[model samples]
Target chain A: MTVIEKVSEHFRVMLGQKKEEHLGTITDLMIKRYALAIGDDNPLYSDREYARKRGYEDIIAPPNMVASIVDWSVGLKEEDLHEDGTPKTGGILPSNIQGIRVMGGGEMKKFINPIVAGTDVYVTTEVIDTHVKEGKKGPIAFLVIKNTFKDAKGKIYCISERTVIAR
Target chain B: MSNTQPLQVVYSEVEIGEELPILKKNTSPLQLFRYSAITWNTHRIHFDKEYALKEGYPNILVHSHLHGAFLTQLCTDWMGDRGELKSLEVNIKRFAIPGETLTCKGTVVEKKMVDGEGLVTIDLKEINEQAEVCAPGRAVIKLPLV
Candidate 1:
């Protein structure tokens, strides 16, 4: 099998494995900067007073903000690579195929409850699925990773599934 | 529980071909760090230059979620407080690294009345200073009739 094929095969076996990760706290400064980075000056995300006035007890983070907190390194550590230079047990596999790039595109379903500052979060990610497709250039790998964010109390905040293509 | 806005855009006034004003956003390390601090993302690729270079990046690359947030801001701002963002999907084609100016712009691609609501489909794009398309997106919004 080719390198890409080996990587794809490895990812196939990684499905259903719980990868534990700890995401730090939510802070007002972080929320405000993220809002600013996106050019959103919404009081709900920035001003604590505005948020309290809006009935939120405190400042709230935006939807899709969980992506900013997910531990991308949960699965494969660089040291885990074998001498063959292939990831052993992660969904992020190298596309042995050439000229195809995977872009991240997906809809995020957010919880009605907002994530407030001072809350510690933990994420447990798993390989949801993988499919091979024939693309314009060549065969592509469409990989999906589902990450669940929870507070220290194990309260679910949001679930984020990122889809990427590797050609 | 709806909030009214001063800059309300009526569905009737917006045309299918109208181009939304583009807002330029510059990505900085501080912004990325702050984002990381809040999100608790400690991916070396986002801040560690050597690690990123080992991964074959020229410098620390921006977080993928940040790209989505950038697009979300553009769409929400255009929709205004009165407008409701029913659905939004962002597909990232390239990375938005630090020290790069990403221009977020959009165009109304389709408009129709669905269930007494003005549903607008917009073609969203984020381009870097080098004119490369970093993140391309699409959004479905519900606008009130003025």
Candidate 2:
């Protein structure tokens, strides 16, 4: 089978598999750096004492913090990557889509609780669906990856889905 | 320090069909890198040209959420401190990469007094340097009419 065909068949098996990803912890420095990087000067995200005055226990990560956590937790370990040192998808996604370039489509995300520093989170990923459409280049495949985050106790925190296209 | 803008706008004075002050911000690779760092995004397409080319893109791509955040800022700046966003939905039509200046604009489309609460509909769009609508979105907000 061609590379694309092989990837497609592997995706079929991943349709409902529950993929586990352990995100270590949320750090204050990372949160501060992120807020600074975005040029957001909101005291709620950068100032701990100020944040407490505003009713938060401490500095909170921005709303899109989940995006970064996914990238870090999903990629293969550095030692297991390709010889070229390029990041590989591993079986995190379908094998057929091992090489397609995927972009972050917008997500419908809800912030259930504030993500404070030193919180260990776990994410469960699932392939929600896959479809093929004819594109200008030829045929393109669209895969939806849904990731659900939960605290150590298994209480759900947030859910996000990314739509990726493979050409 | 309290991050205060020059002026605060209350939702009461905003009229239906009115246009908010538009902002045109220029973006670059450095800015995108800072954003990626802040978001902890290492997609490679946002920073690595070689990786992007391998993925069929001519250059680095911007995160879809960044586009939405820009629009959200536009609305929040317009609402100032008194209004709260109820819902926001953005549909990505095209990609806006680094080195492209994007203009974010919005219009107050509908306004009504619903059961003692003031509601507003704002139509928002982000246009790239090429004048293409990269992300078209809408927001519903609850405002207090002065």
The recovered share of true contacts, given per candidate in order, is 0.36, 0.31
- Residues A1-167 of candidate 2 have per-residue lDDT tens digits of 65555555666676777778787787898888776665556666777887676566788776556644435644556665443233455534442245554555555554456577767788888889877677776666667777777788987666666666555
- Model 1 regions more than 4 Å off: A14-30, A36-39, A52-58, A72-128, A133-140, A146-160, A165-167, B1-6
Give the alpha carbon lDDT tens digit for every residue of B1-146 in model 2: 15543355556788777987886766678878887666555566777878777766788887777787777667766765446565566768898877788889899999888888788889999998778999888877777677
TM-score of the A chain in model 1:
0.78
For residue A143, what is the lDDT in candidate 2?
70
Task: Give the Å shift of residue B15 in candidate 2.
Answer: 5.0
Model 2 misplaced stretches (Cα beyond 4 Å): A1-5, A74-86, A89-99, A153-157, B5-20, B37-42, B50-58, B75-88, B108-122, B139-146
Candidate 1 interface RMSD after superposing interface residues: 6.0
**lDDT (0-100) at residue B101 of candidate 2?**
82
lDDT of 1 by residue, A19-122 (tens): 87876777777777767755567666776776676566788887667665443344445676432233433325543333223345554544434677667778
TM-score against native, each model: 0.71, 0.76
Q: In candidate 1 chain A, where is summed lDDT lowest over 10 consecutive residues?
A: A82-91
Error of 2 at A148 (Å): 2.9
